[model samples]
Structures are given as C-alpha cells and as structure tokens.
Target: MKISTETRMGRNRRNPREERSSFLILCEGPTEKGYFTGMRSRRGPQLDVDIPKGDHISAVREAVSRVSAEYDAVWCVLDTELDKMLTASMLRAAQGSSVELGLSTPSFEFWLILHHAKYTKPFQSADDAKKMLKKISPFWSEGNTRFSDFADKVDSAYARAQQISPDGKNPMLNPSTSVWRLVASIQGRPEAIGRSTGAGRS
Candidate 1:
C-alpha cells in the first residue's frame, strides 16, 4: 500500500497565526487575573488570552452573557467562597454555553499552594488558604502575586492537583481544584509555551 502525502505530513498541521485558539478568561479577583495574564504572556502565538473586567459571580454572568463565536473558549476563574446560591445560579446559566468554569476550593490560593507543596487539607476560607500559602511561599502577597513566582513550578502544581482530584470534574470538592484543567488545556496545544517553541506538556 502506498502512503499519501497528506498522511505522511500529518493532516492536522495549520498556520498558527490563522488558527490560533483565542480565550476570554474572566477571573474572580486580581490574583486569578494576574496569574492568567501571566499565562497569556508566556503562551505562544497559538494561544490568545483576553481578560476583561468582571470577577466572581460577575465573571460567571459576564461569561454567560458574552458567549459568542468570536473566541474559541470562554473561561471563568472563580472561587467557591462566594454566595452558594448565587454561584449555583450563575453556573446553571453557564450550562450549554461556551463558558467553562475553573473553580478552586475556598480560593485560588489553594491552587497556588500546590505549586509549593502537595497539600490536601481543606481550607476554611480564602484567607486560610492565603495564610498557608504565605507559610510556604512568602512571595505571594495581596496584590503582589505574579506568574513568574510559579512559572517554573507549573508542572509540579498540575501534578499535585491531579493527585488531589484525578477526575477534575467537581468544582465543590474541598481541598481540590480545577485550575489545573485549564492550565493543562493550554499546555497541550502545539507550541503553546511562549518562552520556548514546540514545548509540550510533560
């Protein structure tokens, strides 16, 4: 049997600039926003991240309202400490829409903690998670958290999250997080890492 040229070259290859996946990330707060912004800065041209003003429940609402074909994906990065009923309603609204929610138990700080340590202890609140993070990562402070702090440790964090929650389907699991799902999605793309070309998630 003769092999076809398309098969040998791989039929999936395309122009990164033209087919680049664009994402609209609506974060719950400054910390979440800053981390994703840093991700945008580090991702290759194959990915584009657009973060607009909106947070927490507002972010979920914005994501629901802004569901359009303009962007490939709409993500809402939020914490679970907000009003349970309100968050549930917004989450219901997101159903059947393009909006994908990345929820961290208590707060996004829990996800950060995974970067420094493998912790499965449940947090009482965002403040509690922040306190724990401070103990291990003194660099993280209110309004001062940067992506560079955890840039090199992204893989470690992802692995830790997986260990905590392998399925990664629940947003309400205490001491569990879904942020790794979003990060893994981005890292899976070809040439997704901005710092290096052709970097693949390991």
Candidate 2:
C-alpha cells in the first residue's frame, strides 16, 4: 500500500501538507513494531511501515479510532490466552468499548513458524515463529507462503508444540481457541477447536 508519513510538524496550523500522517504501523509493543522494521521490505516500491508503538490493547483501539481512509488496514496483534483482568483491561481499552474475542485454532503453528525463523521470540514475541517459516516452500519471501499450502499442517505441528515441556509456557507459542476457529472458518468449515460453550459438562 502507498503510505505517506508526513504528520504535521510543530503546530503548523495552515499547511495543507502537514495535515497528512505518513506513519503506517501501529503495534502492541516495540518488539512487533521492530519485527516489521527488521524485515526486508519486499514491497520495494510500494510498502512503508509506520506502525505506532503502544501496549497491545491500547494500540489496537487507537488505530481503529483513526479513519480507515487514512491507511490500508489496522491489524491488532494481541494474545489469546488472556486472564480475566487482562481481558477486561483490553476490552475496556478497545475503541468504543466493543468487546470481540476470536482466534485461529492452530495459532501456535504461526508462532512456531515465526520462532523457527527468529523473526519473533518463539514463546513471547512474533520473532519466535520466524523459525518455522523455513520449513515452507517460500524460504526467502518474508512469510511469503501462500495460505493454500500451509492449511493442512497445523494439527501435526500443534501436537508437537503441545508436547514441548518448556520451562514455562511460551506466550507466543500458545494457541487460542478463537484463532483455531478462524482457520476453520477460512476453509469454509465450522469451528473445531473446543467444545461449544453450550456443550456444558453433563
């Protein structure tokens, strides 16, 4: 996408040029923000990242508050296994206070890929999953794998990640039920991660 990063400078009120915001990225923390920065810009001529730095919850809210006409799309990269307090906090932080929770069933697969690549720290930041990207065909394309190819491998990989007795739970490695459901939905299938809330204990 074509992003322009010339935010108005120092109270210059009447300058038409200063009315634009040239920055493009808005991330939960400096790490993910850094993830974008560390990557080779394949967009070459068309891509420029201006992601802002904010706590995951607040950053998402702030970006949504901005006009969509201003940027390509606002991505709120957040965690799935949130505790009640953190959940409430993020929901409260959401723009207009609308709470929507969802995730992909095999979210860890994504994290694993990032971890293997070290683009993110395997259990904590997006950097971790960068590791797994190497197993895919698009080795040099910066997560260039087509969605079509990666669809079937999650269950097998998740089983492996699930078995890992890491000293502690890898935050980035944990998969959310919502993410699993999202993947199912994308395949034109039903949600398959967990029992329905309606499926209470007998």
- The most accurate candidate by TM-score is 1
Q: Provide the overall lDDT of each model, using Cα atoms, as 2-decimal numbers.
A: 0.70, 0.36
Residue-by-residue lDDT tens digits, candidate 2, 84-201: 4554555456535222223211233453353322222223432433334444434423433343344355554333333442211223234322333222222223333342221000
Give the residue spans of candidate 1 off by over 4 A: 1-16, 41-55, 82-86, 189-202
TM-score of 2: 0.36
lDDT of 1 at 118: 88
**TM-score, cand. 1:** 0.77
Worst 10 residues of 1 by lDDT: 193-202
Error of 1 at 27 (Å): 0.3
